[model samples]
Structure formats: C-alpha cells, structure tokens
Target: MIDFKEKVSETLSLRTGAEVTIEWRINIKGVMTGWCRLREAALILPAAEAVAGLEGRLSMITAYLSDSAKQKGVREIAFHFDLDGTTLTLGIELPLEGARIPSLTPLFRNADWHEREFMELYDIQVIGHPAPRRLFLDRSIDPAAFERLIPYSTFSNGANSKALWEKVMARSGNNRKELQ
Candidate 1:
C-alpha cells in the first residue's frame, strides 16, 4: 500500500493551491509515528476557508500552551483532519497575549469541546464559541496551575529529574529553544 502521508500531503496541497509542508516522523526503532506537520502558517488564512476547502472529518484539535509561548506571546494550535484513511495536521499559530481566534465549532461540530478545553485551560478567547463552558477544573481551580508545569520530580521519591532532563537534551542535541 502507498504511504498515506504522501497522498494526504498531495491532496491538501492540490486542494488548497498552497505549498503544504509535510514531515513524516519515525522513531529510533524505525517505527512509523502517526504524527506529521501536514501544513504550516502559509496555509492559515480565514478559518472559514479551511473548513470549506478541506474536505475531511475533523478528528482532533490539540492546543499547546507554554511559558515560552507566553513570553513569545503566541500559542500553537494543531488541527488533525482524517480524510478517509489518511490524516492531515494543520498548524495554526495564535497570539497568547490576547488570543481571539474564530471558533471552528461552527464548521466542525466536534471542535466545540476542544475549543472550550483550550479556552479554560490556557485562558484563550475563542470568538463566537457556541457554548463556552468549563470541561474540567471549575472556577475554583487555581489559575496559576496553568501558567507553569510542575516538575515530575515533585511527585517522584528518588527519580533524578535533572539526569532525565540531561538525557533528553543529549538526544535532542541541538539546543533549539522550544516554546516551553
């Protein structure tokens, strides 16, 4: 069977008439990881254009909120669309300082929950969201918890979080400043 990554990439590029960037990820053991950057900021226009042009079922939407992102003043939102057997991931960058992105729930019914999650967790504003409510951790939940991540070492008894971090840094090699 042909690779779904290539087919999905080609289809989206052709459909959108934009240069869609595709990155196929593979793990150390040569196992295919079902994660790819199907498109970049170049594809991001109006939310309506994306909803109408891309013919697919929205599988999931992942929002990344980080301290560095807060420093940089932008959040990264990824939309995963499943077209038949293939999956296409579209990356959308949102300003964290005062994020107010158009709601995708109007176009994709499933986006309602995901959008609400980000709004509550990351304090983002999803404009025109149908029913923006708290999915988990009500008003009483500490807002500070969302700002910074608690190191796993806090919970571990003898785990050397520093050593683990050093290993991760060694693996990554390049000291690229990731938004976190």
Candidate 2:
C-alpha cells in the first residue's frame, strides 16, 4: 500500500542526480508491479539503496540478450525486488564486450546467488562480490555459455550421450523438420 513507484523515482533522482521513471501496473488480484530502467549502469547502486531503505528485499535477477539488443551490441540485466508483496524491477543495459555491474550482496544477501548465476551464464562481472566463484557450472564449461547460438548437443556433451538428443527425439517421434 506504500505506492513506492513515486518514492523510488524521487530517491533515484535525488541520489544519482538523474531523473528515473517507474511504470506501475496493478493486476485484478490487487498485486502491484513496477518497472524502471536506469540511464546509467552505475546508478543502480543508489537505486538499490533506495529500495533497501524502503525495506525491499531483492527477489531475483535476470540477464539476457534480445535480438534487438544483440543488434544494438548490448546486453541487459534486470534486478527484481519484493516490497511488501509488490514487485519492482530495475534494469540496466551493458555493453556486450564488458558487461559489469556492482554486486548487491551488501544490501541484499540473497543477491549472491542471482549474481553468480548471471555471471556464469551471461558472462557478467559482479564487481566487488565477496566470492566470485562458480555455483552451477564446472570449470570445464566456458563462460558466457548463452551468449551465442550453439547447438544444444555441442553445449551439453556430458548431458546424455553422443547423439542422445537425436535418439531421444526419435523415441519421442519428433522429426527435425517438425522441430525446426
């Protein structure tokens, strides 16, 4: 019931000296959701602080490359926060070559997991993270596994077996044309 969209917008602008906008939507169930995109990547720190001041908890983080973004040569990372059952997402765009963002573990402990996941999967650098170690990925796997369009079989060699995916497809009665 705080209607944090305004407070967050004001806090971000006051702290970073940049105007921030948040779009809010209320579903039929009365749940509120907000989205905002920061002008600069460094502004996320102050933005996160504003949410933390409001007793918001970091819920999840996601990073990805969309077709349009890929054409633009940039990747995007979105940070989600849970504030009294309301959800707010703050997103930033990063260059594809050097995607780096500050770690939010200090303000939100659970951010450690989400940060690590994005680091390995998307080749993002969570600068200042306490322990920037691998969580799900093994050392053998290359970083930024999702950055390119590689075949699933090529990516998961140890997954099933040689041609196992094809075999499974055959067993499932699906053809390559149907899959394509």
- Model 1: per-residue lDDT, tens digit, 79-124? 7766554555667677666656677776778888887777766656
**lDDT of candidate 2 over 1-180, digit per residue (tens):** 454567767876787788878888899998989889998789989889888888889989989889899899898989999988989999999998887899899989998888888887897899899998877776667888887575676567547765666766866778665456
Whole-model lDDT values for every prediction: 0.61, 0.83
TM-score of each: 0.57, 0.82
Q: How many backbone clashes does candidate 2 have?
A: 0
What lDDT is obtained when candidate 2 is compared to the true structure?
0.83
Q: Which stretch of 10 consecutive residues in model 2 shows the poorest summed lDDT? A: 154-163
Candidate 2 positional error at 105, Å: 1.1
Tell me how far the alpha carbon of residue 166 in candidate 1 is from the true structure, in angstroms, after superposition.
42
lDDT of 1: 0.61
Model 2's C-alpha root-mean-square deviation from the true structure amounts to 7.4
